[model samples]
Target chain A: MTLALTLDNASVLIFALTGALAASRAQLDVVGFIFFAALTAVGGGTLRDLLLDRDPVFWIADATPLAIATGAAVLVFFTAHLVESRLKWLIWLDAAALAIAVAAGVSVARSMEVGTGVVLVMGVATGTFGGLMRDVVANEVPLVLKQGELYVTAAVAGAGAALIASLLADGTIWTTVACIATTFGLRAGSLLFGWRLPVYKPRPPRA
Target chain B: MTLALTLDNASVLIFALTGALAASRAQLDVVGFIFFAALTAVGGGTLRDLLLDRDPVFWIADATPLAIATGAAVLVFFTAHLVESRLKWLIWLDAAALAIAVAAGVSVARSMEVGTGVVLVMGVATGTFGGLMRDVVANEVPLVLKQGELYVTAAVAGAGAALIASLLADGTIWTTVACIATTFGLRAGSLLFGWRLPVYKPRPPRA
Candidate 1:
């Protein structure tokens, strides 16, 4: 559990720091930055656990992630002069978070023996939902709804890969590797190609 | 269930329209306003039902609420000039929704036979959590977390009143009235008196 928690906690810090940078960009107060960091850290998993009947949620059960988030938020707020403009860093940081969170969500859901469909949805949720909530809270339109290759679409592919791998292989390690590779590959491809769903357009009205 | 659906559908529009008003006050676009309205409408009950293991979620079980919210959102955006400024009317409208939501929460929880403490918590969740989410999404500190004697406090008092009444008397019209009145009275009093909890100040640093 300690080893596993290390993976999850590392992901939490990465996500929280990104959130703190965003708050600094917005010029929010220290308290506001802490709020944003904490929200980014736990918002998605909390939503998933609440929906899936997982109680004593991760944040509630392990307070370390939250404490670390608070610390990071405070540090960033006080030391804004130390870092460069976060625009470039924020994008890649968000991308890394999306990757790790998708993997973590798949692992958690798989441990519970949730079905493949649920796992896929949960993975996307774990990856994207926190950032979505953060964007909304920060008063920005969600990028996924605008010019992005399917955000959740790639996550679904990744989880599906893991599910299929588990059936074909003998070990959890192979299954996890397959899923992560598939999702990351698909997401990168989509990003490179600007692949997107066809825009909905209504036929012109008859004259 | 049909009758309940009809009533709920009507209320969803009312709540969303009011929420749209609130969102517009923050200068959000139509999409943002619609998102805010949806959250304000279902966010509270979703938390309660998920906690209580209620299936299919009330809004998802019937698409009526979603449709109503979307339609109301569209109307508000196109014809915002036709209506009063949303901020001016937000308090009373939010109060009314809170009154209705708290009563609905207590009744539903009691029907499910949830224990008193959990039931009271659910009531507060149903009545006030959505507004808290709304504030966060609007980039404001949540009013509930402030020192204000506001919505959550009223919901707790009202839920307590409902529990006591339901235990002592038959499930009559009076029970509903008592619950509603208690919440309304408490909220109104808080508003009128500018009631608030004392701000927390850290004690002087120790030597």
Candidate 2:
């Protein structure tokens, strides 16, 4: 398999696992785990494709990702109790998946020759949307929009890096490496060191 | 403009109002209100389009619905307090919007010459997805999936009616009326008198 496809598959697996973990934490049924897992694995790419007016959507065109995601969900469902803390692991897994997904998204958009703005938007959307959907489905506030953490920023930076790298002479490999590294590194740092964006404190009600 | 377009626009307005109400209740800022409103207004149609592989997604092709949603959001942001209770009105508005959205979705799918199953699924997705996204973004369980509600059932019945009506000779008007009546009647009934599906009670953990 090509490096891009390999990374994409890995991201799908990680994302599906995170989704299943969330489902387990929510005490959802087996169907719920599979549904959420598939949703999380494909939701972002689906959105990106729809927005770009891409036909057949990624998952519908190739069912392999769907199969992989469903299998991962089943495995996670059976082994959830063995994992001491599901939510924590889910977050970490999502972080790893986000990096790879962002790179994939940026690559797709870049290949389409869309403008930089569109490419950057697609990349961030591809990375963060799955987790956002997962959190929404699992009934938690989306971590990307929360007061704590720098998740979307990481995605933005990675997407931007990819876009910039694509302009370089030796851009493809560098774009992939930069996008993944920047996103994963920032997200992992946040998990390890509690990195956060400044809270948006509303001004006191006018007297 | 076509009847479908008119109904779609009306749905967008109502859905946007509901989304803005949810944002207000969540104490989100102006940007949040607009963001959530657009997401709620377009979420369902976007999903349906992607699943059906329809080009231009709907809101993207014509910016009017988007403009309407954003305007509604801003208006709600400024005048939320005038509504007495946002959540109560939001639910009722959502019910009305859902019926119209379902009809529009069914019409689109029928025009595409897709199968009954695909049409029905698209209709339900169009009807309920906006509300689901709104609730999720507002950090509440999606009311469509929640127990003690006939939300999805209403959508299914409406979509089914539309599909059945379409098979009849000279069925366009009948299809629209049937779709609207089935969905609105059920939803309004649910609001006026507590109509709900059987709750799923889990068996206690195995010994």
Candidate 3:
């Protein structure tokens, strides 16, 4: 439980930073920054909890995550302009957050003792939906949907790895480590080595 | 409860139609149309239920709404090309849905015996957030957030009217009627007579 809480907080802070950076790029006001930050930080987990019928939601149950996100937004609001490459920073931080969040999702779902399919779906949803919401609100083409992007694929792979690890190992820590390493490794490879999946190409209509 | 269920179903069908129209404009596939339709139909109420800590969200409790949305999506996917002005149809249908949805939200919140402020927030959220999700997913600027549009304003007015009517009258029917009339009337006025709120304009920075 402590590990899950720590992972959730870390991901919330990192995702909030990315959201605030996006707000700065959009030239939104301070309120907009806070709104985006909080939304991005909590969006994925909120969806998970709602679908799983977890009452009160994470942020509502404990306000610390909300406070952390708000603080991150304020911090970024003042210092974003000082960053040399906000986009680069945003991308890397988002990748890191995604890995941590997926692990957190797996941890939560495992604790709940749901089936493997739901656990995997929750992991991917938690890792990707926050960034998806952020991009949609900011009016950017969602990175998850970008042609042949490895974002969702990476999340799925990581979650699968965690499940596999759980079958072979006995501890939550090993599963979590497996999940984060696989997610971040694939995402980082895509960024640095130009790793990609084949994009769909339209074929000519039938004659 | 039956009245609330009827209103919820009505709004879900109308919102799903609008979502399908959006998918048509985006030139997405049949699956995409269904996805958009279901998301828009459930997005707002899901958010409200999560916030209110309602167990097993409405659609999960009753799958009829999901089936209705899917049926609407398939219908629109085949017939949307025949509509000469999809955008016009979408706007009017959305307004009707918004009014019905607000009434439903108010009814549900009131039944739960929540405070007035929460009731008002839920009403607006249930009215506007569905279309907001539709627009965001379609990558179109959200009609609710469009410059000076009376969309959210209309919802607020409608919710306020419901509360005021409750104070003055004795029945749920009266409050629901007041809410719908005020919301649709304001929205129709905005469409027909150019009703709008003042929008924010950036001023030059200090010289």
| Tens-digit per-residue lDDT, B22-59, candidate 3 | 99999999999999999989888887887878878999
Error of 1 at A19 (Å): 5.0
The lDDT values for all models are: 0.70, 0.81, 0.85
Cα lDDT tens digits, model 3, A122-206, are: 9999888999988887788888876766899899999999999999994758999999999999999999997888878999999
- Report the C-alpha lDDT of model 1 over A53-86, residue by residue, as the tens digit: 6768888997998998899889878886676767
What TM-score, computed on C-alpha atoms, does each candidate reach? 0.58, 0.63, 0.62
Over 4 Å off, model 1: A1-49, A52-84, A91-128, A132-207, B2-11, B145-150, B189-207
Please state the error at residue A183 of candidate 3 in Å. Answer: 1.0
Classified by CAPRI criteria, candidate 3 counts as incorrect
Q: RMSD for all candidates, in order, please.
A: 8.8, 7.0, 6.9
lDDT of 2 by residue, B1-207 (tens): 886678788888999989988877766555456657877888888788877877666765677776788799888877777655566888888999899999988887877878778889989998899888777666787887656778899999999988778778444589898899999998888888988777888899999
- Candidate 1 per-residue lDDT, tens place, B8-61, comes to 454466667767766566555555456667767777777878878886567645
Q: Candidate 2: misplaced stretches above 4 Å?
A: A1-43, A50-107, A110-124, A133-141, A144-207, B60-68, B115-118, B136-139, B145-149, B160-174, B194-207
Error of 2 at A14 (Å): 9.0
